[model samples]
Target: MTAAVPTVSDAEAAVILARCDELARHSSLTDGIERTYLSAEHAAVNYRVAGWMTAAGLTTWQDAAGNQCARLSGSTRGLPALMLGSHLDTVRAAGRYDGILGVLVAIAVAGRIAASGRPLPFALEIAAFGDEEGTRFGTTLLGSRAVAGTWLESWWDLRDAGGVSLREAFLAFGLDPAKVGDAARAPQELLGYLEAHIEQGPVLEEEGRALGVVTGIAGARRFLLTVTGSAGHSGTPWPRRRDALAGAAEGITTIERIARAEGLTATVGHLRVFPDAVNVIPGKVEFSLDLRAPDDADRDRGWTLIESALTDICGTRGLDLASTQVHEAAAVACSPRLRAAIATGIRSTEPTTAPADAARPDEGGSDSGPEAPADDAPRELPSIAGHDAMAIAAITDVGMLFVRCAGGISHHPDESVTAADVALAVDALEAAVRALAADYPAL
Candidate 1:
């Protein structure tokens, strides 16, 4: 059996929380946190966090993509690393813990591991990804994607709100655009990737648990939908009017209905109508559709049905229907190897709250969990929100731990987590890393 994982002290927990507040100060928004890619805010946080990593006993450096990274050599001369981390960027007006908590927790965990002086078979590394939220450039996971060797050449042309192209921003940030590829890591360089993030949902809190296991991430697709019709007088006869807005309203409602019935997550978040004159009937409408599902086949099927419904809605309204696909990502499941290790970590720590009875094999976790967890097993669920792990999945096996966030709130200033939970999470994360290290004995 694996040795019992150590629990973190409250003082350690307090330090992690304090660093989050300090990180918030680097934001551009005085009222709320808003750190973007390649901004001064980004550089500030990288420099600050790199200092913390060094104090934690790791060799620190910034990658070509501007991500903050640190490493501790293994007992052997060379070996692929057991990686840990999460992104540091936040959405505009974001809550404090969304991505911030994960990085801080990783640092604290690294500190504990380094202080122990335990020998490991694999090196340990931490990655504080720079641009997971994508608030500035309108593209998510830019930092992790670049590191995964999936960076698209066309992204250089992508511009921020200030009209600064990504290539130009790279120069301003003092990163060589041509050398960005140097950040990419081959599969052999990393044994696996692990991330700890706020639940960003109420599942664990609602269940009175401080942490949970993430089974997989939802697959997502986004589209720009347009409906076109002829302009007409406001008094036009009902049968003669090809009202694009009316059709769009129906389409939005239909999307919600289908999403509900098909078990998908769909939203018509943005909508615009042309010909805004009070007297003239609107002739064109444009809307954004964000569709997601537990898996690729489910998402694709729901999209097909929604598309067919929109076609029929427009056909009946005498309007034309068109759609442009903008973004797509396949569902990614946690690696069984890493999942078991995380489960071990969680099991080794006592639950913050009592569970009704000893948790059986089926009480929590994915159906494929290797074994039953402890008496108060961590709740298991899927993540609907995207993460840097999704991008990293392209290069190596991935796993994630979700700490409870108050009220399931994220992307707002009200996001919150408890010190007790943070301490538990820190312990769980460190234990997981230790478990992975034990798997490969020192050379």
Candidate 2:
């Protein structure tokens, strides 16, 4: 009868590294980080994360899609919460723990569950979001797609790169772009979402472990394409040149050989071209793409073999393709009872032993009982970038917990992590919120 070691102190790992160096001193690059979305360093990191969510006792606020919320209460008062969070916006020379160390490790695991007075049956919010690195409106999960009600009134005519617009940066950040649909909420006011973040890749330091268990989140698409043709005089003669950046460099190497024959994850990042004369020849071009998979029918079958190899590489170079699909999303998964409570919070962070094919049979359900998932098995993975839990997994049961960063190097400033792997990611997200309140209790 000994299972109970989820710790995390050291003054809660120096109050989550001094609140991630006090939100990287409200950035916008005084020579480093940037912090975007409704700017002014996103309102001084949401007024210092609502004063560290009211000194961690919680009950804060700031939502209407600018996110930064808080709360607490459980075992009573209007339950249904268990949210936790991430995203505090950043991206230009960013990385003081991408998305502020998952909202300061969910307010240091809700201040270690309100100093263990133990009552949790649900309520525990948190958030912090403010636009997951859309970096001032490129449109990534704008504050988790307005709390998953999926906001998109044409993304208020998205613009910024200085052209302004996301409704004049929400009325110059004072907010009220028609109350951003009051930041939608409703999946019965939630009782799922988790988060934690920072594995930014290298699979928990190549499985030497420090938490892991996302198995879902990659379902992107993006596109743009373009191509066109007929410009000339790069000594125009090669059959009257129809270049369009050489048919968009052979359609970006056949979109990297059909996303490397379906193991998926394409990219291209960006391009452009037009007639920028290096003696001309190119006519248009454009580019972009992106892709990504881990399902959604293999990211719509690799965008149908990258739109049939960019329509046979722009119809044998007479070039004229167009495209568009600016973004898609979809795949999310993670709830076989929260991937068995994030694989029982990465086996409560250590002490291992069972793996001769670790008791099979329970497929993805992982036999959700005593927080089941340890016979040395839990290392899920997936997430090929993009989060705000893919727009709060369209309103509920999300789950994630990564951790190990160092060489996965996320969005710049040498993206690191360690304070003993964020005190084992706040004791594996407080043992995945007490293994989902012992597998969903309190009716």
Q: Highest TM-score: give the candidate number.
A: 1
| Weakest lDDT window of 10 consecutive positions for candidate 1 | 360-369
Show pairs that collide, candidate 1.
Answer: none
Scored against the true structure, residue 304 in model 1 reaches a CA lDDT of 98
Over 4 Å off in model 1, which ranges?
1-8, 277-279, 351-374, 441-443
Clashes found in each candidate (C-alpha, N, C closer than 3 A):
0, 0
Off by over 4 Å in 2: 1-57, 63-65, 71-83, 87-125, 133-136, 139-167, 172-228, 231-238, 241-246, 258-264, 268-283, 291-374, 380-382, 388-428, 432-443
User: Least lDDT summed over 10 consecutive residues: which range in candidate 2?
Assistant: 353-362
TM-score of every model?
0.91, 0.36
Which residue pairs in model 2 clash with each other?
none
Report residue 404 deviation for candidate 1 (angstroms). 0.5
